[model samples]
Target: MTEGIRSGTAVGSFWAEEERCGGRAVALPSWLLTTSNEEVAATVARLYGGQSRSRDRQQDLFELTLDNDAIAVNVDGPEAVVNRLVLQQVEEHAPIHVCDGFNFLQPMDNAGDPCGCPESVFDRKAAARSGRGPKPDARLAFRLAAAPDLVIFHLTSSTWEFSDSLSAAVAGMERGDNGAQMTISLQRKAVTTRSGMAVSYVRPILSVIQQEFAAPGQLRLAA
Candidate 1:
């Protein structure tokens, strides 16, 4: 799944259906996914685990801390199956330039792909030179990684829509007669300085999958 994500195949997906209040449903948060255990553990260990770190786990809630930055996972609400995960910087860091831009996409060349090919092109320099690109604004970076039912994120300056997709999928399940679940993956390169102190989360390489319904009551999942 991670490999597929890296090659730009798997993406956030959501399915909607209508179901009764009771059914077989599963909510697997990223932390609960075993495939990413090594990666997540290594990240924490390298970044803030050990002497400088404090960790705690209580039932469905888990927490890890390093200096002023912290990451937490807890059950999401009246819905015990769902989870809410968050990362926060206790003390704001120096402002950094963050830019969000769109580009014209190009068709993939399978022949050049395995070897080398420019899948999409964005003339950032040209835009900047022509004053078409917006001025860099001070902001933070947030990068996310995912595998099927799990998602991990590093606080920095990127946008994520995993929750939205999950909600849509759950809504679909609620509307369907049979139970449903989905798994998707995401991968993207993260940017960091030599010291690794200054970091930036690049935007995801692939587009997210989405589903929408005009009628609200058509499908509603458990809270």
Candidate 2:
């Protein structure tokens, strides 16, 4: 390992990084669901396979890592069962921002997308600071060849109760239960870069999702 750092040798992730302030940054840790490395690998490869092979095939596959314990659940797709199953288990819900994890989401160099979508929490933070609320990346959703392929549903609960049933609704519900959808902000991000599209999951996302569904828990400031 270089510099005595293991630099995690995962096929689709980055080495854990720390910011200038010594705060940890961009750690593409995965809390794998029923989704197997094989399934993720297969889906990603299939999505990007037909395209002319490039030296860097990495960009096509997205990497979302949740704090191992934070993920209450995760479901994999055969592209048959439905991607909604995957959303059911998610607990991490940080907003994307440019300064945070979503540095990849800036104006694209090409006409692929006129506006840059968020890639990570940093991108969400930058957008939040601006007048705009949570905006999901359209291209990311559209790029996938599904009619209802990658829909992101935002669910907000009044009493702060997060139940598996609630997750089921978030993934599959077309309408919110009692303005619960109105309470939470939802956004979708499609990562496209030279290295291939990639997205990392952080704890803040979980916090927001939790806030939307459940009462505020103990507040712990980052060191």
- The candidate maximizing lDDT is 1
lDDT string, candidate 1, 128-211, tens digits: 334333222111111222221243232111123343333344454344333322233333344677877755332212222322
Instruction: Give a tens-digit lDDT track for model 2, residues 54-140.
Output: 233355444332322331211111111111100111134442221112222322343233234454546644554463433221100
TM-score of each: 0.22, 0.17
lDDT of 1 at 81: 20
Per-structure clash totals for the candidates: 19, 30
> Measured by C-alpha RMSD in angstroms, how accurate is candidate 2?
18.8
- Measured with C-alpha atoms, the lDDT of residue 173 in candidate 1 is 34
For TM-score, the strongest prediction is 1
lDDT agreement of model 2 with the native: 0.25
C-alpha lDDT of residue 44 in model 2:
40
The local lDDT score (0 to 100) that residue 53 gets in candidate 1 is 20
Q: In model 2, where do residues sit more than 4 Å from their true spots? A: 1-23, 27-37, 49-223
Let me know the TM-score candidate 2 reaches against the reference structure.
Answer: 0.17
